[model samples]
Target: MKNLAWLSLGLMIGQFAYADPIENGISFTSGDWEIVCDNTRTCRAAGYQNEDDGTQQPVSVLLTRAAGKNQAVVGQIRLGATDTDPTDTEVQMKINGQNFGKVSISKDGDFLGHLSSAQVEGILSSVKKTSLIDFIGKQQKWRVSDKGVAAVLLKMDDVQGRINTTGAIVKKGALTEANVLPALPKPLITTVKVKSSPVQWNSTQLSQLRAALKATFKSDDDACSMLTDPQEGASEISITRLNDQKLLTSALCWRAAYNEGYGYWVIDAKAPYHPVLVTTDASDYQEGKITSAQKGRGVGDCWSSESWAWDGKQFIHTGASTTGECKAVAAGGTWNLPTFVSTVR
Candidate 1:
């Protein structure tokens, strides 16, 4: 069966942050505002152009804030870069038809200059009330709806425990900000140390082993339909030496139009060969890591990928992320938007 990790992300939204020592991540959406937070409690909230404003432009503003007392909220404006995207190199910021000023393009063309402290303060405060936020260019103008800005920012404040604090972006007061959550250091992961080499096993034994692995997919036939279908070969078992006590095994498990997945597991090197499954959506394995990369859609505009490191005894999840908002800016999207980050030794 395909791993359920990807689908689980969406279902896990709004689950409260800093609930434990280390959280994989959390996401939340309110109207046009969406927030994606990482393991370290660094959050990025993105607000998109109004969908019903007669014309939809692929413009968005990202508000990023790290967890800690008195951390500043940084904002950046991103204009779409797809074939259908805007070509304007400059844009004007307006709130309620009042011109804020010209937003100049920096050396990095993806954004106009990032909002200054004064601009950030103004926008956050304005969005909390009934205000029209817009960016007008020579050719086109885009409006970022304020419908959900207040709610989304409020949630951000809550997630970081900034609500009611002087540092809070939503509702600020004289409350002390000394107790706001501090930014936790990133979790560290070490890579697998042993070098893997292939080991040959009896052909009949391989077939039987493959069957056992397939049986592990007893449910989620719809999400992992390939498991229930018999199109895959049964003798596709592959075994490799992971360490002195365990053997790594893999078999073709699923196939899609532009990608295929293999199931990887670990078993006893000796007889009985009790197996423990790792993942069924793995696309490829190398040195000491397994990875999966799949396009978000047929256009190949966006992609999501994950990786695991075979750390000495067991496989450890190392990373999982999607490229930033899929505006067709690049073939696989433009920026690294990781939900999980770990340094491998």
Candidate 2:
């Protein structure tokens, strides 16, 4: 199984200074507006053209909205490494009816939008600044959506609103809908269970072994750093027998994948015996490749990292995991799953 990390609302969204006027290429609905944020941390309004529903445009904008909130917008967008020039690369934004906007992000990679100032004041008119609680008491439902940019969606959440206020923001009376970007789907990591010898392992030791397994899987894939999202990648594992003896010791192990081909590792030292470093089918990794020096450290076909000796017991180390929303490439359908790594303990 893969280690998929789900980033809760608290970790995904952040606040930054607003910069640059709306660019010309980006067009918004007469009443609807859209913004594109690229990987470089730049946000900008993308230019667009609207036609009747029957129009022949093959590429349509996809949009996600916050629940109860009106007119969703793309909150944060990212650019590809090759896509250095925002204007040249076409970033798509969609929510509700689709085609919210299409345009290149600015050179600096940032964009911002307000409802023409007039719209903001109009929405605020109903609220009283003194007793703000009563002024905007209506609930806002928000959903997040965007095109698949590969690794860009990692660490992003859709349902969570972006705000620094201590309390939730509510709308009272008939307030025009607010448009926020759709949240990315959470990624799924691999799930595994490690088995150690019952005689040699205690509950506390088992828990410690489990933790060690989790760490091994994380270090191998770079999933911790790359943001493992199993939904977008593939993963699988195998168990290898180490020693040949009358009372044999065995380890239940897991090796999974995320990203293009990043793999995760999970292991359990079921017995006191440690397995000898052997050849792995994996490439870019091998036996005895461990960075930390100790006895029995090695690498092989395994790609991510290597195994380590933890607490007098030998354990494997892999990579970290991450979560984000993504659309399936073939269907263009929405997908979301929380943390990918299932409990191994």
CA RMSD for every model? Answer: 6.8, 18.8
Looking at model 2, report the run of 10 residues with the lowest lDDT sum.
129-138
- Give the alpha carbon lDDT tens digit for every residue of 1-345 in model 1: 223532433233344443433377766677777777778878888777666654666667778899989789998776664345566777888888877777765545455457667667768878645788888888777777776676667767777878779998865778888999888777788766665899998877876676666566665553334544665434367888888999888877777887777778888887667788888888888888889887877777578889999878888988877765555444556455667878888
| TM-score of candidate 1 against the unseen true structure | 0.82
Per-residue C-alpha lDDT of model 2 across residues 1-345, encoded as one tens digit per residue: 112221322232322122222121111121112333322222232212122222211121222223223333332333222112223334433233333444343454332122223322322232222111101101211122222211122211122232321212221233233433332322222322222222344566544433443343435564322223334332222333222221112232223442122232323335432323222222232232222111111212112222222222233332211111121111211111111112221
Residue 311, candidate 1: Cα error in Å is 1.7
The alpha-carbon deviation from the true structure for residue 296 of candidate 1, after best TM-score superposition, in angstroms, is 2.7
Which candidate's lDDT is highest?
1
Clash pairs detected, candidate 1: none
In TM-score terms, which candidate is top? 1
List clash counts for every candidate, in order: 0, 89
